[model samples]
Target: MHVLTKVKQPFNFFTESVIDLDAVNFWLQKINPLWSSNKALGKIVQKDIAADDMVSVMIQINRNFKFGQAGQHHPVFVAVNGIRYERTYSLTRLNAQHVLLTVKKVNAGIVSTWFSEQAEVGQLVEFGLPYGEMTVPKTASPLVLLAAGSGITPMLSLIKEMSKTQQLKEQPVKLMYWVKNKSDAAFLARFENIASHYANFSFHVFYTQALPADARVNASHAALVTDLANSIVYACGPSGFTAAAEEHFAAAQNVQTEAFSMSALVNDDIGFVNVTLLQTNKVVSIPKGVPILAALEQQNIKPKHGCRMGICNKCACNKAEGATKNLVNGAQNTERGNLLKLCVSSAQTDLVIDL
Candidate 1:
């Protein structure tokens, strides 16, 4: 029994140097793209053009994929023209084995354009673990969800998750979706079907470009809520709309907002700072007020990144020295040997980074 137990102990393949995992994975992927020793892969099973500029893809995720709460985003890695680009997209789980990903084509967006024009049904893609703090709260407070344009993707997921429990009938849930026109709306029929079944759940579509234009979310809309102060509000949209929602809902019990894009901050510092990349031994002068990821990309140094909004930690790197300012909150940090998120941090001084 002791001899058998000794043989059952885990083998240290790296220290023993007995096998090349990369080489093995290469051949395994050739046989089956989803077959891997340890990787989260998914295959696109269906594709639908939800709108002229929006595409909905149904992906079949593998066993290695780690599932999370409904309102989180997952980093999807795809190779276009032999260059890997990573982007984070909100996902709606269809079942234990399938998920739906919606992509909206933005101006000069490579991945979104590819999905809108060239993505096929059988293509394979890699997915990182889902990450985000915006999710359905456990408390039974009345819920108010505000979504604009593509921001409706996560709201759809959160609503579906709520529908699975008895809470959908017990709690008051309302969704206010804003779009330029009714044609641009993605899941109008689905929301309608859900509202028909549950008396406590309802949704309203606001068209901003119609003959009788519906104004964006404002105090007038807040008056529609029965009890605004006690409701838990979740808002997702463009930066301007998200900022407005946060300001308008300040009196709510809880308010969570996620902006899809953020405008670059105009820094007060006019000079430049030298940033040293330890891995490549390359030094570049970057604008003092610009985020490190953007500054590095301007110098033709592309580091792996997902969700330029700083939600995903894919752009985080080790900072050996120097100070950084948080662009999101205007906080300054001079701590050494710390991890810095390049998407949300600007160099405050000359710095060394392990990239």
Candidate 2:
């Protein structure tokens, strides 16, 4: 039976309060790495190295694991040198027994660096509820997936889901993947195989810094370019790539995007923005196009934060008075009395906010 379908464990007030749960869990691991309580989330089952400094971690999800949409991401908690850190990664369901999470190492990124270089197969990790809007729809409508670099992770999931349904053979789906070079395009073989198997599913790989020199955001197959307006385009990538694709396809009928990092709001009035903290009664001059958290941190005002990519809402606060723009997706929110995430939000004007 599925773990979620099983009856909930009865709470033991005395055991929970009197016993050291941490000590008990530690002992359970001594017997066998996977011998922990059902309440204990999960452990890393295997780790596979990939091209372009990436690692695919297979996890044995515990009874408490809640399934998420195919293209959603979930926060993962891991301890490195005794300190816990949280980061978000897209979940790829391989089977009920295990799942895959592929992480690309960011230069000097703590979590990614740890996983790529040091993390072991049997190390424990915990997952939070998954959430994202980049999921594939039930019906296929000539899908156009534009992915750059690591952004292909979710797109891969969606493509595989379609392949399982044998829709790729009949549906008109085009994938334009941009990478710095061939090495960075980690899943080239898998994509090529899928495209070869399905005549309707065409795959194009562009190397931005390599030969076949015309790689760009506007670069798509001749067939896909003509139908851009009618087909639904889901683009995911770095801030620059996603922003460029969004602008290039601005007139498209339906364009949905998800940026892994923050993009800046492009406007003529780029200048220093004066921000007043309502709670602390402190004022700071922040650059117009930088994350509010980074600007504030430079001025010695540190707000609590986890998963600085705007996934975790730990740094979210009230806008209170002024407008701000998200570095990711390049969207602006001017409404007062709204919650804004500081890690991805940049000041659009001199403003007051509840820090």
Task: Kindly list the per-residue Cα lDDT of model 1 for residues 212-261, writing each as its tens digit.
Answer: 99999898888888898999999988766777788787789999988787
TM, every model: 0.84, 0.82
- Look at candidate 2 and tell me the lDDT of residue 61: 79
How far residue 99's Cα lies from its native spot in candidate 2, in Å, is 1.1
Evaluated at residue 207, the lDDT of candidate 1 is 94
Best by TM-score: 1
Model 2: lDDT to the true structure = 0.79
Q: Number of clashing residue pairs in every model?
A: 0, 3
Worst 10 residues of 2 by lDDT: 6-15
